[model samples]
Target: MATTASTTAPVSLASVTLEVADPEAAAVFHRAFGVDAYVGLRAAEDAPADGFRGFTLALTVSGPATVDGFVGAAVDAGATVLKPATKSMWGYGGVVRAPDGTIWKIATSAKKDTGPATREIDEFVLLLGVEDVKATKQFYVERGMAVAKSFGGKYAEFAPGTGSVKLALYKRRGLAKDLGVADDGTGAHRIVLGGTGASFTDPDGFVWEGEK
Candidate 1:
C-alpha cells in the first residue's frame, strides 16, 4: 500500500492593514510617491482573513513599547484604542486602533520570508499628495529626483538612488479614481528634502519633505 505525506507551507505578511476613514485619502497619500493601488475595497475587505494576497507587508511603529505603552501612544495620537494592548498567545504581540479606525496588531517577529521589517538607516520613502502631477515632477527634478518613468502622463515615478527612497508625483483625483476610493479634497502641498535624516511638513502649506 502507498501512503501520502502531508506538509504545510510557511505563513507570511502581505500588506499592512491601514484603517482610514477614507481609503481614497490613504491611497492619495501613498500614490504621491509610486505605490500602486493594485487592490480595491473588495480585495482589502477580504485580505485579512486570506492572510494577505501576497505582497510583503510594510508596517510603521513609533518605537519599541510594551502593550500598555503602545495603547497609550495610539490613544494619544488622535486614535481610539479599540482593543487594549495585551499579550498574545504568540510570542511577540500587541494591538491598537489606527487613525482610520482599523485594528492593527503589533508584532516583533514575522515569518522569515515576509521581508525586512524596516528600511536601512539612510533609506526611506516619501508619499505625498499633489494638486498637479506635471508641475510636481518639474519641482522634484529641480530638487534632484531623476524621473525614472511616467505613467500615461498622469503619474511620474523617480528613483533618486539607493541612499534615498523612490518618489512619485500623482494627481489627487486621478489617484483616488484609480484606487477606487473617495478623494478627500485636502489639496495640501509638501516639499520633501532628502539627506537630512529626518522629514518635516512645511507650515506654509507649500510642502512636506522627507530626508535620509
Candidate 2:
C-alpha cells in the first residue's frame, strides 16, 4: 500500500468574531476601544484577506466552536488551547471556550503565509459594561470615532479603519449578558486600559482609557 502525502497546513488566528445583539453598536464601541485601526476594519466579505491594507483585527461572522480541529491546532502550537472547538450561535468556524467560558473561535480558513506581512500589534481591548447605549455611543463619537455603520437601533459601529488602534463601546447590560454575566456590572467586568493610554468611564458605568 502507498502512503498519501500530507497536504493540510496549520490554521492561524485570522479573526475573532464576537456575537452581539447589535453588530453595528459593537463596531462603534470597538472603535472607541482602540482596535478598529489595528485590524484594518475591512469587511471580510468585501475583499480577500490580503485585500485588507492595515489589519488591527479581523471580524468573521460565524457560529461557535464545538470540535477538536480548531483548538487542537492551537494546542499543537505553544499556546495552551483554553477550550475545545465546538458549535456556537455566533457562527465562528470553531469556537474555543476560554477557561472563564469566554468563547474564542479559531480561524480555519486562514493559512500561515510566508510573505512580507507587517504584523505589529500596537493595541488590545478591555471589555466593559455600560448602562445607557445612546449616551455611550455619543461619548465615543465625540472623541473622534468614525461611525462606520448602524444596524437599526439595535447596534452601532465606529472605528478609524486607517488610524492607530480601534475602539468598541457597547451597552453594559447587553454586553454582560453576552459574556454570560448578569446586568449588575458584577464580577470581573472592569475594562482593561491596555498599554499606557488614558482611560475614562461612561455614563452607563463603563470604564475605559487609552493605552500608554
Candidate 3:
C-alpha cells in the first residue's frame, strides 16, 4: 500500500482567554481599556503565575494620541505602568501590567496623531517568548502556519488568516527586555489561545484549543 503525506490546516487565532483571579474586575478593566471585545477573562484564583508570563498582548493603534489614550485608560483601570508612552526610534508606545498580571503593550508607528484619539484597535498581536525562535518557527510551520515575516533567529510572525489576533514569536530574554520585565517565570502561563484547528499545545507550552 502506498502512503500519502498527511497535512493539517493552518491554525488561526480566534480568541484569547486570560486566567485572572477576578473575572469581574478583569472584565471591567478590559472594558475601560476598550479591549474587552478582544480579550476574554476567566477566573483562576489558584493558577500559579509570577513575574513575566513569557508573553505579551500588543495593540497596534493609529498614532501617539491613541497610544496615550489606551495606556492612560489602562492605568486608571488599576494597571501598573511598566513603560510610559514615549517616542522611540521605531515609534511611540507603552507597556502596562494589568491587575491580573497580564502584560500589554499599546503602540503605533506614527509619532503624530493623524486624527482624534479613539479606542480603536487596529491590530491585536500575541507575542510569545520562546527559547529557540528557529525551532519554534519550524514547529508552527509544520502545523501549517505560514510565516508572514522572519528575521533570522530573532523573530518570526505568522499570517493571521481568518483570526482576529496575529501571532508572533520572539526570543524570551529579548522580549522581557522589551517589556521591561525580568525574564524569569515558573508556572502556568494563565493564557489560552483559541484556534481554528484541533486543540494542541505549542512547543513553549502555550495552550491552543478549538474555537468556541
Q: Which numbered prediction scores highest in lDDT against the true structure?
A: 3
Tell me which of candidates 2 and 3 scores higher on TM-score.
3
Model 3 residue 116 lDDT? 98
Query: Model 2: per-residue lDDT, tens digit, 1-212?
Result: 11211223211112233323334644564443323443322222321212101111222321222123334433443223433343344333333332212333343232332333222222333233344546656665555455665554345565533334344545555554444334442332212223222444445433333333
Q: What is the lDDT of every predicted structure here? A: 0.37, 0.36, 0.89
Q: TM-scores across all candidates?
A: 0.35, 0.42, 0.94
Sliding window of 10 residues with minimal summed lDDT for model 3: 1-10
lDDT rank order: 3, 1, 2
Error of 3 at 35 (Å): 0.5
Ordered by TM-score, highest first, the candidates read 3, 2, 1
Tell me the tens digit of each residue's lDDT in model 1 across 1-212: 11111212211111123333466654553443222342222112331221111111122233334333444544555445433443334334444434433333434332222333332122223333356677666655554447778875477767645432445555666644432334553321111233322232322133222332
Model number with the top TM-score? 3
lDDT of 3 by residue, 1-212 (tens): 11211337777778899989989989999999898888888887576887788999999999999999999999999999999999999899999999888999999999888799988999999999999999889988887889999999999999986768899999999999999999999988999988776777878888887644
